[model samples]
Target: MGIITGGTRQGHEPELTGVVIRSSAGHLLVAVDGTIWRCQMRGRLKRGKRQSQTVAVVGDRVRIGAQDPHAEPPRGVLEEVLPRTNRISRMAARRTGGHVEQVLMANLDQVVAVQSIAEPRPQTGFVDRLLVAAERFGVAGVLVLNKADLPEPADQKTMWDYFVSMGYKVLRTSAETGQGGPQLADLLKDRVSLLIGASGVGKSSLLNLVEPGLRLRVGEVTGKTGLGRHTTTSTELFPLAGGGFIADSPGIRGFDPWAIAPRDVRDYFPDFAEPQQACRFRTCLHRDEPVCGVKEAVAKGRIPRWRLAAYLSLLGDLEERAERLGPRKRP
Candidate 1:
């Protein structure tokens, strides 16, 4: 789609071009130049398919007609949604144990999957899945290991090295000590990046360190559960001091790949891409297959054992979900 500057339109009604910065319920906050407008989607746009919870999200460029030109808090009606380059989404649960795609943000450049080494311990599975999702959506992915001052488990350290060896950019950060903030800032400069991770992993803390003005509310890990209390209720995009934008989304404990088949999961892992070509069967699922290049790589110490285990675990989850749904269409 062609880009248009603000206050430019072709019709009779006065429409201002803006980007959706935040959406809650049926109201959206659109930013035009230095002004912010509260808007509601046009009637026709509200009839979007029910597969997604909302039709518009943060980072969507839109055309809006002013509801009141002189109101204290400006009001407008969202007239049109411009084309999006790409989006990041997750599989939200359905009543029948099925999954629906939930778009978290649109037009993002990269996903920074944050994890903590100590409190609210890191789950490699979650990080890996986010990277896979990033790959599926054609977005760059970065692994941020937060709370670097805390002691890390031996396995996790090895896994970190493995990810680096596999060509994934990994950063060790400590929001408390400001370690690795400059490096992360350099990478995030002038880019629209999404910061996502499990609760209490310091996604907010890290943002605060990078841009002190953000002052995003942060919660501590509960003593009993060792999980963080949800601090950010919804996803919202914020501008960084240096440059670019970062969307701080609510902490997510569980994430299932949306509309993905078990066989497609292996292709998302970079280590499996080249080796799987040598497998005897073209459609090998890499599980219990007689001549599997992936399995062979695992046995030969080429691919990390824990990563393969994580992949299998996700595959089993998908299989169980498919079984639950019985006969359903695959995208």
Candidate 2:
């Protein structure tokens, strides 16, 4: 889509273009110049067929009609949404049936998967899914192990090392003592990054440490559930003092990747790339397949067994989803 500058369109009132900093309940907070305008999407934009479940999300560039001078709190209409360079998305259940693509963030430079060392414990399954999604969407992925002040289990340490060996940058951070704060800050500096993880993983706390001025509200894990309480109700972008912007989203309990076919699941698992090539069958899912290189690597200790387990779990989910949805029709 071509850029739409602030000017008259076919003799109608002039329009203003800006980046969408936050979106909720069909309302968008667009940053036009230095001011933020509260706007609603145009009817036409909502009526058209869309690839993502959300019409517009945080980090989307949009065009809005000029705000009315007499409007009480400054409101406008979002006339058009600019094409996104890229988007990170997941599968969301549709009320009617099946699943839909839910875009988490658009035009992001990287995706940071945050997990804590202890307290609530780390869910490597969640981290793996995020990393796979990042790979599928063509975005850089960083894994942050928060709560560095706490003691880490031997197995966790081994997994961390394995992640590094797989070519993923893993940083150990502590929101309390500022451990690895500088490295995290440097990674997020001058870039549009999206922070995602389960609740109580210290996503907000780490951001507060990186940029104290933010003063974002922090939540604690429930004593009974040992899960983080939802602190961030909506996704919003905050400008960093060091340059660029960071988006803090509501904590996710689970992640289901969207639009990934069962056969294509192996492509997202980078560790399987080298090993799967040696499989007897070119179309190997790496599960129950004879002479699978991936399985052989696991047996030989070349690849971690946990990684294969995670891949099989995700593959099963995709296979089930595809079966329920039936064969996808070619457009």
Candidate 3:
């Protein structure tokens, strides 16, 4: 069958439209009308001065040129990437100098930040960073404490409640016992979601439980380091039987949101908004600033101290990065 039919013509060549389901090593797997096409991007798309951002990523809708008729499996060239609704991105770890925005996925409806209840312990800082990035990118954020069957510390339960109180959907799930599977499945039923967390947090295991047919490989947390091993090496979108799709990505050790200025960081932390309004300076970052409403809230136990610490940690990173790279124009 033809790669795609009834598409708009571009200069007499019919252009097919598809969603990029998988992208790696400069190649993309575009899904067109239930068919998967192994495609390469047109040279022009990458020839410009757009080196800082990812050109295409999973969940991106793109228009591709006609496929070679004789090719055994469908193959095509991605001619253009359509505008994305939203995307989750982070500063790529660069061994050289400048920063590169790594778009984890495009057009996501929500991002599920998964963390285990025990084993490897919780990385609240990482979860905060992920949720902040989601907030900045206009994607809904969900916090999942996986391995719920394991004993959970009282403080962790308190933290979960705090996130819920802040208007976040927090789910306690255990893949081993099938707990919260239905709730998670319902949440993911018809939404384009991305599951992200540090290694060994059971992202794959949860996927396996929710969608058993996937049989995604699961890894164990190393006893020596108390860290989970990387199981999912690359990002790929999987269609759900119920509806919609979910993208599984490799676990990240750290997350630094791309192009976010230190001053703009507070905007992503909603809990700080109310308290920040009472600050002496409108531009106060709530760190070492006198008469700061946020500091006062923390002191009065109105806001959790850990939340401010997380905000300060991310703000400090962005400020340090700005010092090295200078001011960045907002996108």
User: What 10-residue stretch in candidate 2 is worst by lDDT?
Assistant: 91-100
| lDDT, candidate 1, 1-331, per-residue tens | 1133646456655778887888888789887876888898788877755766677888888888887858866899988878889888876755635645688888889999999988988875888788878888889999999999998889889989998998889999999899999999998899999889988999999999999998999999999999999999888888887888889999998777776787788888888988788789999888888889999998999998888888898888878777776666543
| Model 1 lowest lDDT segment of ten | 1-10
Backbone clashes counted, model 1: 0
RMSD of 1: 2.3
What overall lDDT goes with each candidate model?
Answer: 0.84, 0.86, 0.87
Q: How much is 292 displaced in model 1, in angstroms?
A: 0.6
Residue 248 Cα positional deviation in candidate 3, in Å, after optimal superposition: 0.6
Instruction: Count clashing residue pairs per candidate.
Output: 0, 0, 0
Residue 253 of model 3 has an lDDT of 81
Alpha-carbon TM-score of each model against the true structure: 0.93, 0.94, 0.94
Ranking, lDDT, top scorer first: 3, 2, 1
